[model samples]
Target: MTSSAGFTASLGRRRAYWQAGVCLAVLLGAVYLARSHWPALESGAGRLAVADQGWLLTGAVAAAGTWAASALAQQGAVVRRLPGARLTATQFAASAANHLLPAGLGAGAVNLRFLMRCGLPPGRAAGALAVKAASGAVVRLALLALLAPVCPGLLRLPRVSPLVVAAVLTAAGLAAVLLATPWWTRCRRALAAVLADIRALHARPARAAALWGGSVAFAALHALVLIAVTRAVGLPLAPLQVALLYLAASSAAALLPTPGGLGSLDAALAFALTAAGTPGAGAASAVLGYRLLTVWLPLLPGLLVLAVLVRRKAL
Candidate 1:
């Protein structure tokens, strides 16, 4: 009887694994079909035949660098030392997982599990994630402020129409309502804990430096990839200008809660490039090249790593 029960439990676990694999396959298939029919993506794929291969390769290399930077930032968030190889691999896996879940949920879930496994309490693990996110946002804004003066007219916001004003007001109202809820106090307490964690983590100069430096490098690497893509497609924008545009467009797209910023980010990037005077076809090509390097190329390998880590119980 005991042996039969154990066999049945093992069979159930295998069935669950099969179900997850099928779901992931379905999701990837749907994304591929959607991209195939998207006109901009179609044009960009065609332009790839004529693009400079060297520049595209450079962009791909830069994409890889972002994963290392992310791992560094995550390590810096906590006082406990994490295994370097596993942490980096987790970041690589997280990048692929981000596409599978919405609003950063996939990566966040993976990292949270990692932190818990590292022996951090659940609340502290969450606080560490918050600190990393907050620090990253600050670094991006600081970079934008520094670059705006150098890249004049490159980060222009669109003229605010009545609809924009209404949207802003409605958002503000919603935020106020949210804050008035009973849950707001809990949120405030969570924020306070996160702030305390940040203070403690930053007390060590090395930790502070790693956190800030890794964040800046991570954002910069992303911009560099975009710049490389632009050059590959023969767009004439300066590097600083392209970087600034990337920051602005990415910030704007973060407002949307999509998985991996898929649709919103791509559209915002294409718009920003065109606004900065790149031809429409070139902008489309650039976005395509950038996505190809950052998303499509690493996706399969990242997922494979994710599967390995899961099977090993590393995440």
Candidate 2:
């Protein structure tokens, strides 16, 4: 029995290795396909390099702030149930996994696992994750709503009409309702029963406020990062226009199931940049640079964190 169990474990490890190898191959192939537009990316990078160093610094700060805000939001979601869980560590691991693992689901899974490992009940963990997801959706929707009125100018190059904008917003609203209603219905009785339990351990309202505010700030900063890259590469789009395009493309990419939305994000951003009036070459460069900061930069740290967690038997 012991030998059979060992063999089974070995086979499982080998299968995991094979799967990882396949994922890596797919990722490389996608990057190669993306590289066909390298000329544009090069020009954009050159343009950005020629810009004032201030823009680069500002972009870095903005990116960092965005991550910090997101960490706080995650921390707030679980605070009520897992009071003893280390929020900072949880955020780091979760964010790292979100970026490094294939499919965005990895981060959420890691978060739930972490909470469970720390002794939180499954129901509470699920509830916290649901709340966190809902809060994030609310923040994104609010930003989209705020930006909806001015979308005409942003979509001017693409000639996206006001009717289209309205339709998109209406769809988003419907989707949100659909997603929430079923969950609410299923959990209604449980929620009612646990109301006192939940209320007794309420998360800090101030933390929640900060989390939402920070989410908006992070979204704004993300746009600014792209704008800075555009300036660096000498692309000609206004800040607001760039922000609107960024938001639209990013929101669309989030729907994709690819690891970190890899290929989808690049393609979407490039298209959005073109729609915002940038030439193909410049748009490609901005996308590459943005990926550099957002994806590649975090990869090393993510791997390091994963290694540490594994060593500690925490992953």
Candidate 3:
């Protein structure tokens, strides 16, 4: 029994190390991807200048709140207490890093390092991130389902040919077989640690609340940011419709693997806006305004905060 337990713990460590390595690899790719795609999106963001100042400010506030929500979610993921101010600052920096790198490259590395600095075992730290990510995905999907009914036909599933579906299934099956055969034992060992961590987390009511609440707030707040921007630019869509559209666009953008979901998200959002009865020009401006509030505005300050945290070795 002792030997089995020891092996599980070691496998957990391996999984954490593996996760960290993947983050670093993606960070490098994010750098490459961000540079290539930056110029394409840069031009349209300036159009947000004409949006209503009041609505823009509201979106700006919502954008900032995303980081706080992230911090809260992070705090709730682990049993230990994290220093609130420092954690929020780290999230700010992480956001900048996420923007610069894309996906979660910058942000994941930042958070993972901070958790380690706070004395979490590498495995547990990595598990915490996994739990947070899983919760966020769940909340996003939940919101999407709930909002879909309110806005009829706002989000439509594209028709996929049977051949394409078959190909995807085949690919997935092959990959699963390739990994499952050799790594099944090790994978189970690692998953044991993850499941144990999750069980422990759920045992505490407060942490569970924070975990789910922060996740819900994070998604809702982002949608609110987009809604405010859309309204500011005089998009014809209702606020609820805008929220639904943003959720759908963002959910779809997850498939593209773009750093920070940049080109894909921008394109998807504008397309969604146009599809949902927004004029073409209005859609473009709305997308621009949303990006301005969420990305361009806070970028510098976030980077500076990131620098401060690194200098202080807080991340």
Judging by TM-score, tell me the better candidate of 2 and 3. Answer: 3
> Which portions of model 3 show Cα errors greater than 4 Å?
1-47
Residue-by-residue lDDT tens digits, candidate 1, 22-72: 545545654774466467567767887699999989998999999999999
How well does each candidate superpose onto the true structure, as a TM-score? 0.86, 0.71, 0.84
Candidate 2 ranges with C-alpha deviation above 4 Å: 1-36, 45-51, 79-86, 156-204, 310-315
- Whichever of 1 and 3 has more TM-score, that candidate is 1
TM-score of 2: 0.71
Mark the regions of model 1 whose C-alpha exceeds 4 Å error after superposition.
1-41
lDDT-best of 2 and 3 = 3
Clashing pairs in 3: 102-259, 102-260, 103-259, 103-260
- In the range 168-283, model 3's lDDT, one tens digit per residue, is 99999998896767567767777788888889989999999989999999998999999998878776788889988988899888765555776678778977987887766677
lDDT tens digits, residues 1-315, model 2?
999889879978996676567567666766786687677667766765566567666666666566666666655665543433344455556666776565556777777877677777887776666656666667767777787687666654457899999999999999788668855575676666345333433456765665566567667878888887767666777777778788878788776555776776778888888876778877877887677666677677766775676577564
In candidate 2, what residue range of length 10 has the lowest lDDT sum? 193-202
Error in Å for residue 150 of model 1: 0.8
TM-score of 3: 0.84
